[model samples]
Target: MTIPEQIEAYLTSQPQAKRTDLRALHALMLQAIPGGKLWFEDGKNSEGKVVSNPSIGYGTRTTTYADGKTKEYYQAGLSANTSGISVYILGIADKAYLAETYGKTLGKATVTGYCIKFKKLADIDVEVLEAAVKDGVGMTGEN
Candidate 1:
């Protein structure tokens, strides 16, 4: 299935959800970041189209960093019924130092070379989160 489809399926299978809240939160994350073609669309990896189990809501957006590295923001389906909302930042592998430093800001964050997954939007520190995004993918923020 496509990313949108995957999101739909996942959300539908959920026993409970806060759809508006989750979507708004996701949109806020995209808006808070800097330059790129922000989009609410599917993502393709070498493996094929990304999928969100049980329709949790999957999406991908692209952004450019200050150092000239481009980054992708990917979200898994809406999982308010199970794990809440998950937001992912790409290029973690290239931003290990940033992750190491800002990783503590969230208190509980899942780290990978190219991804940081947070169980809830509130768990993220907006300032630190922006800095990490800028540092990780090289996106410069407002003055």
Candidate 2:
């Protein structure tokens, strides 16, 4: 399936409320980060075993791992988990930036080094999330 189809399938697989939230988030990402590449990761490794939750990715970044391997990956990512949804802002140099800049203003969401997690989109401030996503895109030089 294509990336858009995979994304649609992922969103449709969610419960009604979650599906709504995920769609809104997907739309927000598209608008906030222009000219970005859309991606859907099935959470499978080379062996095709699921290692993480399937995720929707936006934009792009080239990252160098600790092992000195460089990889082109999504600048931001979104996923639904058993407890909540996860929004990832990758390629931030400062680990504390997200939490420091948007944590308190993000309402009920949990902001970590590169992730914002929340049970419901209603519980968090969508505008704040948008700012963070745009910032992530800019930081990755994709904006």
Candidate 3:
């Protein structure tokens, strides 16, 4: 299936409340990065083993590994976790940016090196989240 279709299927498979939150977040991500490329990762490794939750991604970046191989991936990602949701902001040079800048202000969310996680949209400040996402996208030079 296409990325949008895969994302829809992933969201549809979520519990009702989580699905609602994910849908809202999906819209918010699009608004933050209009015309950004869309992506869907089925959380499978090359062997097709499930490695993580399915994720809906946005934007693009080229990443080079220590082994000298390079690959392109999303600049931001959204996924439903066992407890709630996670938004991954990639390409930040400073690992502390998210936590230092938005951790306390984001309400009941956990701000990690590249991820903002919360149980629901109502648990956090959407505006703060948006700002963080914007900053993240800027860090990747994706906007």
- TM-score, each model? 0.48, 0.95, 0.96
What candidate 3 gets wrong by more than 4 Å, as runs, is none
Predicted candidate 3 versus true structure: per-residue lDDT over 1-143, tens digit per residue: 87888899988998899989999999999999889999999999999999998899888888899999999999899998888899999999999999999998999999899999999999999999999999999987754
Cα-based lDDT at residue 143, candidate 1: 12
* Prediction RMSDs, each to the true structure: 7.0, 1.2, 1.1
Ranking by lDDT: 2, 3, 1
Native-to-model Cα distance after best TM-score fit, residue 137 in candidate 3, in Å: 0.9
Using lDDT as the yardstick, the better of models 1 and 3 is: 3
What is each predicted model's overall lDDT from 0 to 1? 0.49, 0.92, 0.92
TM-score preference between candidates 1 and 3, better one: 3
Q: TM-score rank, highest first?
A: 3, 2, 1
Give the per-residue Cα lDDT of candidate 3 at 93. 93
* After superposition, candidate 1 runs with Cα above 4 Å error: 1-21, 40-82, 92-95, 139-143
| lDDT per residue as tens, model 1, 1-143 | 76456555544444434565466554555454433433333334557766642323223445678999976544322234345544555434455765577777755666555455666656666567555555544432221
Q: lDDT of candidate 2?
A: 0.92
Range of the 10 consecutive residues with the lowest summed lDDT in candidate 3: 134-143
